[model samples]
Target: MSLRPNPPCLNPQTPPPPQSELDNIRRYDVKAIANYYRRRPWKVLGRALEVLWSFGFFLTCLLWDQWTHQVEYYKRQRAEDLRELLTKLGPTFIKVGQALSTRPDLVRRDFLEELIKLQDQLPPFDNDLAFQLMEEQLGMKVDEAYREISAHPVAAASLGQVYRAMLFSGEEVAVKVQRPNLRPRLSLDLYLMRLGAEKFGRFLPLNLGHDLTLIVDEFGIKLFEEIDYLNEGRNAEKFAENFHGDAEVKVPCIYWQYSNQKVLTLEWIQGFKLTDIDKIRAAGLDPSNIIKIGVTSGLRQLLEHGFFHADPHPGNLFATLDGRMAYIDFGMMDQLEPGTKETIASSIVQLINKDYLALTEDFIALGFLAPNTDITPIIPALENVFGSAIGQSVQDFNFKTITDDFSELMYDYPFRVPAKFALIIRSLVTQEGLALSLDPNFKIVEVAYPYVARRLLTGESPQLRRQLIDVLFKNGKFQWQRLENMLSIARSDTKFDLLPTAQLGLQFLFSEEGLYLRRQILLALTEDDRLHTDEVQRIWGLVKDDFRPQELVNVAWNAVREFSLAGVSTILPQR
Candidate 1:
């Protein structure tokens, strides 16, 4: 049978609608359609040619590898060629390359390294054009806005250029002026890239575990957000708020009056780059301490506040003479939802405890796997990766090694790294590499453990609190081993006290809330309808010794007896 649908039937006496009526009912403009066909052909042809050239270059590289049987050499050469092509393509592709540098899952290590070298250091546009744009954007002449402005840009980036200028009030400021005619060009480029992605997906049998179109859309959104200097100004303010009163961490202040969508004025920071170890040492700053400040601040941003600076490359961070770690260029930042933060926190706890089962559950909870995915295989995978480092000192732990191992597993599993998670990983890995460059012995995990441990012990989240309760009171008895591990981690920081935690636990166990909790525990122990009498006796034994007043023990015992009288059978196993 033919699958084609029947055409619409026409009655012999019925006439079709009038031509004028049909034209009026039309949903599209014929003139616009004709204009699109007329104007778009050349542009489409040009883009197609460019894509064909890129494909040919890569295909040639692959053919060369096949002919010579030199896989690694050709791979490196291909990466270099791709980097050069991306650079020649201008700002949009450069930004895409930068984003790709962060995705180790998408690219090999060598290619990623080469892509990271794709600096957005385009030549500055005409100084007169910049001045004109500043005037147009800020509604004032450049001379009136600044007492002195640099004739040449101090730094020229892909999207904008920064000039060191002094305000009329004698305050030093960095004036960032967006490139002339950038928005239209960027918009067109992004649209073309989206079209290319769609076409590529249609033609290539690719399984990247994510939609290429969606990735391009996300990258475009991020790039557009960076294009708006006002959005960047707000991001700086938000980060400053997160680190308010922190003397060690500094965020450049934005001058709102002098700032607009196309231009930004920020406090000019006079400091050496964090990677400038010699200058930092000459300025009487300890590089190790500076690294600590950076790591600790980053941890607080990631774990405590759930907001983080996504890009902390050396150029974007500086160490001041006063030993403050100053962060600049707030164009790219990431935020973690509260639930993601909790999952990360729990994962840290599980990692510290070496609880592979719990870690597997964390992986599932974090959406790293499908809901019905069997995590048994993942548990062993994690153990294989982290087993040797389980009981090692924090100073001996290497986050990079663990990350690499996990990346290897990710290649084999059906795991998908969410964009935010990938950004977090990229930020940390970059920060760690920078820190190690300054101080070879730097261990980020060592500096981060105290904070993670303290949060698990003191966090007010009900989920965390329940986990802590389960850890301390397992099988209806206090687990001294778990308590010792918690204490050991907390004790490393002299400022963290265990007294408050102990008092809180004691208070919870003595109040009416405690009696209700005890009753619930008894009910849970008997919920299976076949309660082990010894388990009940053991719980009663602990209650008798631990309860402050005798009446509390009696109440707990009576609850157990009530459950026993119900359908729950009390079976005592033979000793």
Candidate 2:
């Protein structure tokens, strides 16, 4: 983790951007600033202020060198400052900056730490402006735009603010207002990021071989899509439609005519967030049931359907009075290539089977690790960690102990990954933290097993089965040979090191051997099915399948629907 103080290539000047890359500046709408600020002079003043503030902060950091402090004072101050500023900047800058902050490699640690502090405390936008934006977007005033609109904002986010409102058709709705002049300000920030990267490459570890210009120009285009309210409004509409029929969850209906590039109006939902324990209790709902609802919705969004909300924070979620979970914002959505989802399912299975090589390969495919990096040391490193995890299977494993060891190993020899991939890791880590907060004894693997098993049954087709068979055959043979070798070693006069080999062997056998443990799955489809099969596969192994445990519940629901209509025993008569 320590950098050589001044490595030869480290301080070299970045190569100049190609002319074609330079043309990307055109994608930025210079005039959008005028529209948002409502005057050319204010746009100029805003840019000047941004420049002055940035330079002043940089100069202060460099000159005085507040080198020592009681408790990381500078880092804390920076974070607090970022939180305040994002709140002050309305919405667009907050959103754009957050996406940047998630890239630890893109910004320095002090700033990233500070930006993360903005997570919950950014100030809400003016409700009056929210109404004005609604009028502007729909080409009518608030009274005309909706049947009823809640005066209060239910949630405020980096990109926009959400308020509960109702349309003329008697539909309750949530209206999101994009801060005025956000489009132009974010474009400037994108340019500023390029400048910072080129000028300060040594301070950051960007993608090694790519030109700074190309890297940032691509970043600009993506950020461009993010600030566009129109696109975000569309994203919301599409997701609302995707989950429209689901009863356990709802994506608010979008009011497109009342939505524009600067505003959005959708169905309003009154419910408590998943993390709002007191409110959840007040609603007379079980926290466990709410957890299940959130988990199941996330599974459906990510698995059966590839499109999903990139951020699933508590603020973006709500639990209804009757117990259904509500999803609101959709400004940032992530769509996985179909294969990536498959790789994840198989990767978990690989982890269960302890196939470190396939696990490493899957990491590469999933963008969890650097491509072309030496993975040999890593394979052993993982074996040491994953082995400890599987000695009792994922269900029985103590993740704190296992992860501490894994974290130690990773800290010792870390690998680089893309920012997008890192964000996914961040989400899982955050979710795990939330789960532990709810109950320290909670095991994500245990909770997630049902969802994984369901996906194994449904997400995978016969092609997946063929691949599963091929992979399992190799892994099983490998395990047999490994068991034989260990046995052979055990007979030797000298006791060999089974610790490492045993660990390595365990990972391989689980992922490979459990590939098609269908009978074990049927057993775990519910608590009552325990004796349906004499043999058992570890629940974690079942979780590793392309299937999700939630899918099992879905199957049950469909069966119930069938029974309500037909009165049948597709409902599993007995154990």
Candidate 3:
């Protein structure tokens, strides 16, 4: 609530009492501003220039509506321009772009594709400046700390620049040195965003949770954590620990003694980015196989383990010499709260089974939809695209298909994805595209299906299960009830207006509308006869042929059997 956060401890974590010549230099109180700004008025005026640049953002969006067609054709161009502008504007603005890039649900495929280019591409800081910052943060000169520091930064961005370096023992490492002055700039940028979101809130829509306050707060937290490389160090360590014995995935070990708020030192890993098909091939590895490993492992992290890398682009992921897949940059990791992981897992399973009702419930549980909205239309809308039955599931639907469908649908209404799980969800969805790039037949769902099935059968983290139930009841209840009502009408009435019945059943089968009704049918029928699809279809035909009894037992049996959910819940992953 205040401009300043209270120190995490009674005594703050800062440089220890100055001993060496470097440490003897005045340490700027991280909590207190340095004299540079107050001592000089020009710096204050410079901040004003930044403020104007921040306000200039509206000019771009003003043309957003006008450039509709151009936006599509020139997506890459527009996104690169935006990324450059974001970088120029600094971390707060870059943060906005980064967040938007990871949300394919809220953006178009091309747009998201273009935005990924921003992740590791900011102009590098002067190597001399980086050396100075490293010395300032580590309390030692460059030579005192490392045997050889690459003056040329291997990677650089808003908060830091990474250099390939060698420690005293000759171990090669990568060092991330924070910019000389970052906190003040970030705070100001955040201030501008806060002011902007507040101004925009007067017309903010309900579904977006359009709380600029919350968005700004989250950004602040992320930015602060980003600067504190120590936390990132821990995250990488934890991830490495998780996959310790397994050789398929490797997270670089953190060199903690040299890591601090402004400088992070870790083992430098050698590999090619996941997207570089040629390099992966040149390394005597199958790009397709590596893609498989990336997708499946990512799914396990999000839906099973509840922790994941927010950005899994090629720049942040790679295939090591031994064919081990490695993930880097823990600066942006997302942790699914209780129920989220399960909801996502269940949603995928439901989609695979073409259980619209299950997906609807899952959506509701995950808080993607309101608990009280009419789900009749959405259910049928899904079936219109995905079809209904066990084999013809949404999971069978490929990434390109989803991109096409969601792209059109999103134009009308922003397909809602919860804010907290935004990064993880988008990463998984984009992974489909990355996989398809290497091999045309690569289906992210196919790759993820085995892990999904394994988790479902073995039971997942509690968070995932909670989310599944939430979707079924919390958000999809009305649709379920409506489905129940439709079935009840068809069962009891002599005059069966079957259009409403079929449509209602279809919608209920596909999404929010029939989630509960389908669940009810499955639980009820499974209890009675183990969910015979032929029987289900036979029942459908019986409802249709009740008046015209033309010896249709065989047809009814066949249809129900074909439609019976046999092995629908069964996982099919061609691993």
RMSD of 2: 14.8
Tens digits of per-residue lDDT for model 1 on 1-575? Answer: 11111113211112223333212312222333334434666765676588668768777877888889888767887888788788776688777777677566568888887886764345678999999888877777899889999989998777888999998777789999988766545555666666678777657655345667776666666777777787898898889888887879878878877887779888899899876799999989999989988998998898778888987877689998789899998988888887778788778777867778877778888877777888878888888888765436656777777777787777677787766676788788888988998999888777787777777677456565566665556456544455556656666776666545444444444444345455555555565576656655654453343345655555555444443342222222214
lDDT of 2 by residue, 1-575 (tens): 11112112222122223333222333454344224334445545676587668657755764454554433556666656655665565454565556555445446777776675455446676877777666655567788766676667766666666777766666666677766555455655654555567778656643333445555555555556655556676786677667766778766655556666667665667687666788788778877766666666666676567787776665667878888877766765767777776777667666766779988888887776768778988998889888877676566654445444654565555454455544455455545545554566666665454454434433244434433443444533322322222233232312233233323222322333332443334433443534423223433232234345675555444434433332333223336
Each model's total of backbone clashes: 0, 28, 22
Number of the top-ranking candidate, with lDDT as the measure: 1
lDDT by residue (tens digit), candidate 3, 138-202: 77788987899876998876678899999886678899888766766765555545656777765
> lDDT scores for all predictions?
0.71, 0.57, 0.62
TM-score, ranked from best to worst: 1, 3, 2
lDDT-better candidate, 2 vs 3: 3
**Candidate 1 collision pairs:** none
Q: Quote the lDDT for 401 in model 3.
A: 63
Residue 69 miss distance in model 2 (angstroms)? 4.4
Provide the TM-score for each candidate, comma-separated. Answer: 0.76, 0.66, 0.68
